[model samples]
Target: MLQTLKLLLPALIPSWRFFDWIAPSPRIEIKVNNDWQEFRPRPDHVSFPTMMKRMVWNPYVNENLFLASCAERLVDNPADQHSYEQILNRILADINDQKVTSLQFRLAFIHREGNALKKDIRYVSKIHDVSGAQA
Candidate 1:
């Protein structure tokens, strides 16, 4: 068990950055061996090399009734050599480097209106868009 934990430490640990060289960065790089010479190249040279979307929580959208967040944007092209997983890891590393863990607290909403009335609110959680049509 100890040996397994030690081996898996790198992947599980949160990567952080430092002004000094003591703390090394988590570098992820991927190489594809698609021989261009052996195979015929596609007509569209402008094809995206990598694409990914990040879904993160939005503090601005938080309310006493609901919580909401959205995808900021879609990254169409990233490093050509990096795979999707590699790019994800790189992004995670950057986020970890910038973010600092802190304590969590609960906030209550206090409102006064309508004869000083309070109503219990219930929100419906929709998982996804289940349209009949294909994506």
Candidate 2:
């Protein structure tokens, strides 16, 4: 069933972002001391990351049909802004409570260009300062 849904999702939704035509990847980066590293759920961690991604991509984040909405701004929706902020705060607080010095989010996309085809981190969003953040 899941596989069928995944295969048919594109046809049901023609929007590129909705279909994830260009893979948009997100990673949480945490700073410890002076160095930064990727943050991953513990082996025991539950479905938090999946929930976060879903919340980020929910349609309430944007409704401006005029502007092309990028996957990076998933949390900028007006309707779900407050809820998204709460979820974000909880994640940040959890990291900080675990003694992480700082936190940020990085979003990247994979695509092909004129002559060469490659997969790499093409762009990263602005660094979010979650150092000593309570929320």
Question: In terms of TM-score, which candidate is strongest?
Answer: 2
How well does candidate 2 score on lDDT at residue 84?
38
State the weakest 10-residue window (summed lDDT) of model 1: 64-73
On the 0 to 100 scale, the lDDT of residue 57 in model 1 is 41
Provide the lDDT at 124 for model 2: 37
Tens-digit lDDT string for candidate 1 (1-135): 998899689778856553444221111121212111111112453323421111254332232112111100112232222333333333233334333232111112223455573422221111222222122
Computed on alpha carbons, the lDDT of every model, listed in order, comes to 0.27, 0.48
Candidate 2 whole-model C-alpha lDDT, 0 to 1: 0.48
Q: Using lDDT, give the best candidate's number.
A: 2
What's the residue-level lDDT of 56 in candidate 2? 65
lDDT for position 104 in model 2: 53
Expressed as tens digits, the lDDT of each residue in 1-135 for candidate 2 is 998899798898766565546543443334456565554433455377866885767443233121123323443443445443543554575575565545554323345677666545433334566654643
Q: Which residue ranges in model 2 land beyond 4 Å of their true spot?
A: 1-20, 41-71, 74-88, 110-135
List the pairs of residues colliding in candidate 2. 61-77
lDDT of 2 at 85: 51
